[model samples]
Target chain A: MMKELRTAIRAIIVFTIMLGLIYPLAVTVFAQIFFKSQANGSLIVNQDGKIAGSVLIGQSFSSPEYFHPRSSFAGTGYDAIQSSGSCLGPTNKKLVEAVAENLSKVLKENPGVKAKDVPVDAVTASASGLDPHISPEYAELQIPRVAKARSMDVSEVRALVDKYTDGRQIGFLGEPRVNVLLLNLELDRIKKVSNRR
Target chain B: MAGSMWFLLFIYLFTLLVLSIPLGLFMAKVFNREKTFLDFLLVPVENFCYRIFKIDARAEMRWTQYAFALLVFNLVGLVLLYLLQRIQQFLPFNPRHFGAVAPDLAFNTAVSFVTNTNWQAYSGESTMSYLVQMAGLAVQNFLSAATGIAVAIALVRGIVRKETKTIGNFWFDLTRSVLWILLPLSLLIAPLYIWQGVPQNIHAYTDVNTLEGAKQVIAQGPVASQEVIKELGTNGGGFFNANSSHPFENPTPLTNFIQILTIFLISAALCITFGKMSGDKRHGIVLLVSMILLFVTGFFFAYKFEKAGNPQFAALMQRGTVENMEGKEVRFGVLNSSLFAVVTTCTSCGAVNSMHDSFTPLGGLVPLFNIELGEVIFGGVGSGLYGILLYAILSVFIAGLMVGRTPEYLGKKIQSFEVKMVMLGVLISPACMLVLAAIGVVTAGGMAGISNPGPHGLTQVLYAFSSGAGNNGSAFAGLSANTLFYNILMGVDMLIGRFAMLIPVLAVAGSLAEKKKVPMSIGTFPTTGFLFVVLLIGVLLIVGALTFFPAISLGPILDHLQMLKGILY
Candidate 1:
């Protein structure tokens, strides 16, 4: 029994160092050497050389001039450090009410859009409240409002939305969606150019 | 379902079957002590480990010694992990400088990870530091999995070695499993995960200004390294609270597919290993087919219900036109999310690409049902193979009773003692789960953790205990399980669920190891035939369904009926 105890102790410590410390460090070193940008949170930069949010993580976009991301259940909304989901059951009244409230809000924000016209992703909360993409249908629903708010031709904003839209990987995986932050950033850049003109 | 969805499902299963074949053969070679492609590089390191630990490489043991060694090693691991969490604030690599975890949460987490449960009462990125994530949790992710593989190999040894008192050396099996198998696989996959946008650094959370200029703090960590093992080991604990749903943990659709595949890779391959070891490849193939059949059936049920979308939203929008999107990532869509949920739950790999709590009731029930089904559908690594084998024994015993002949499995007679041990092993989880869940549902402390009301609340309580008792780390997430009542109660439940079954399994192995192989006879049932597969699956389903039917009827079944009637809970 004593011999077994000693063996257990030595084995645990040795294995811990090898697996817990050395293995992860080795992987990190390899990642840092080969895929430096991705290994460091995939941060996207602004025109002013400021650190904007990651292209992968979604941010709250409430302004009428910008495209909005999905409704978030993270702390308040889009609290990146505290990632989470609204774990409300499908049949829960709270979820139904929350979806209804979001639907009305979406209808109010975009004039021509009706209840049926709104994409489900617009009103529904994402699993990671930090979901970066919104369905292309949701993005298009907001196009008229974004164009009206920015004092630009609807086609121009539509063109920008089209440019930022990401299709299914290999054309048949995942869903067709738009990155809200990137599209909004592009809108801001084009707005600046038009202002100068 | 769309034709495309059917195509995607076919591709996923086809890929899994194709990939697991070579891996299964390789694993057989690995444990058989035959030379493999990586042996030249890994053999020296393996020897060094044995030397440093002072393990006699040639020394083997009976089942009692193997079980004792495993228990002691796990107990030590549990204590070390608990202390690490308690003092993590004082530990290095804590760039976040988060304070020590609360006592109850720490205790729960320690037992959770050490048992390979990985059930998270507290969210990551907020509570755990980088060091604890790597040293405490991730180490267990490897060791606990290796422990599982060791026991499985021990069982396999017992089956194949005719009339032997000894099974195999626990130390040697543990070392070779980690060094030759888990490590090599992780090293290959970790880089792919990092390249796909999972962060692999120990930097502090970066404060970023959004385009709209709101302050946001992005959490960073050594995620890719842990992510590989988390799936590969079927550990399911995540670096972030959102688990695989967080874009950082599972970035692209390709990565999501890979993560699901990784969860089943070892468990599926072990079937092939079992076949090769049993000296009859057909024996293993029969079990694998039964597992796949169960898996495909569950996936179809889950996908159909999820694609139908939620009923309450029928008036708010077009129902058929829009699938259930609540608590699901847009990138994964409905199909991938449903597929992920089914795969994760069935394999006892609880990492979720979507929130299961918000799944349409019947869709949610599929995962809950899968876990309740003993997770034998290509279950967690080594645990899965051994679990299905237990059912196979039970099936033969029943067949023997039907006819007037002694039951035999792998050519060993199934006596009363063996049958008793099998019963104890099979009954432990459901008994632990249901009894604990009953107490949880009626008690104030457990009820307090429930996030939804009525049947849904019941589902939450049931899911937590089931996941724990099944050694499956996934959760409904809405359950506020960090409370003192839950942490202690579920902690005990998890230990019972793991060791109670494990000890009995080892005992069965020891008993079997002593018996001489029975020869084929006219009355001997062919275990490699289609009838045996049907019987094996039937026994598994009957045990699972009979035990769990009443409880699920009150939970998801009730919830589904209520939803169709436009009732809200």
Candidate 2:
């Protein structure tokens, strides 16, 4: 029994060092060497030399000139430190009221857009409040508002939205999505170039 | 559902089957001490581990010794993990410098991982330091899964070997499970995750100024390494609070698909391993098919309900997408989210890509039902095969009684002792789950943890105990389960759920190992084929439904009815 206990203790220490320390460190070193940007959080740097945000993580985009991501329940909205969902059940009053409010808000923000045109993603909270992508349909719904705000043609804004939209990975795996951050950033870049001219 | 949804499901299952057959055969080869492709490199490592463990690779043990070694190793692991969490502030790699965890939560977390139930009462990013996450929790992820696989392999030996006092060495099996199987798989997959943008760093969380000018702290860690094993080992603890739902952890649709496949891979392969080891691949396929059937049923129900969307939103939205998009990523949408929910629960892998608490009542009930059915639908690695095998034995026993002949399985007689052990193993988990859940609902302390009201609140309480006692770590998440009452009782629930079933399984292993083989005769019930699969599944459903039906009706079923009646809680 004593030998067994001794063996158990030694086993735990050895395995912990091997699996816990050595293995992960090895993987980290390999990742750092090969997949540098991805391993370092996939941060998107703006033209002004400032770290904007991650391409992989979503941030709030409530301005009229930018497309919006999903509704978030992260700290105040998109606080990566407290990534989480609004754990309200399907029958909860909070969820029902929130969705109704969001629908009305969407309709008010975009002129001539009906309730039927708004996608469900426009009114729902993502599992990770940090979800980076908006459904393509949600992105399309915001194009007219973004164009009106920027005084750009609807066709020009729509083309930019199309460029930012990503199809399902490998053509048929997940839902089609648009990276809101990238599209909004491009919108700013295009506005600056046009103003400079 | 779209035709695309059907195609995606087909691809997932086909990839799983194709990958698992080779893996299953390889595992059978490894455990049986046969040569394999990786042996030249891994054998030296295996020898090193055995030397440190002081295990005689040649020395076989009776079931008692095997159980003792496992218990002591796990006990040591439990103590070490608990201490790590308590003293994490003092440790290096604590870039956040988080303080020692509260006593009750620490104890709960320790037991949770040690039992292969990675139930997180506290969120990972805010609570655990890097060292603790790696050395403490991640280590257990590997070991606890190894422990489960070892027990299963031991049980397989019990069925295969005849008139022998010895099964196999626990330390040997444990070492091989980690070094030979879990480690290689994790190593291979970690790079994929890192390439797909799961962070693999020791740096502190990054503070970035967003385009909207608010500061966002992007949590970074040795995530790719841990994330791979988290799914591969069927240990679903997440490094980040939002788990796989966090974009950093599962960046793309391919990563999500890969994660699901990895979660089911080893557990599915083990069925094939059982067949190969027992000299009957057909029986393994039978078990695999039964599990697939159960999984498909649960997935169908969950997907249908989720796709139906929430009725509350049906009034406002007339077109465009109206699926239940709440608490689901746009990248995954309703289909992948629901599929992930069912997969995570059906197996003992409880890593959630979407929050179950926010699911449609019927959608949420599908996962709850899967867990209540013992998670034997491609269940936890070794645990799933042994679980289904126990049902196989019970089925034959029932068959024997019906025909007035002695029950035989794999050419061994099903005696009363075996039946008793089987009954104890099968029934103990649900008994603990239901009884403890009942206590939680009745008591004030338990009532305090509930976040939702009415029948939904009952579900939050029931889901916690069910997740605990089933050794499934997924949660309704809205349940404020960090309190003293939940921590202690659910800790007790997990321990009882894991061991009470485990010891009897070992006892059955011991008993079966000693029994001489009875030659198959005309009267001997065939343990393979359509009839046997039906019988095994029938026994599983009947036992599960009988035990959990009443409590379930009051919870999710009632919640669903209330939702239809426009009752909000």
lDDT (10s digit) by residue, model 1, range B142-220? 9999999998889988888888899989998898889988999999999999988999998989999876667899999
Candidate 2 local lDDT, B1-569, one digit each (tens): 47988898899899999999999999999899999999999999889888777778889999999899889999999999999999998899999989999999999999999998999998888899999999999999999899999999999999999999988999889999998999999999999998889989999899898766667888888999999989887889999889999998899999999999999999999999999999989989999999988888889899988988777787767653367989999999888999999999988889999999999889999999898888899998788888888889999999999999989989988899999999998898998988998899999999998888888988998999999988889999999999999999999999998888888889889989999988888888888899888898898899988888898899899999988788886
lDDT by candidate, in order shown: 0.90, 0.90
Q: Lowest-lDDT window of 10 residues in candidate 2 chain B? A: B314-323
First chain TM-score in every candidate? 0.94, 0.95
lDDT of 1: 0.90
- TM-scores for all predictions: 0.98, 0.98
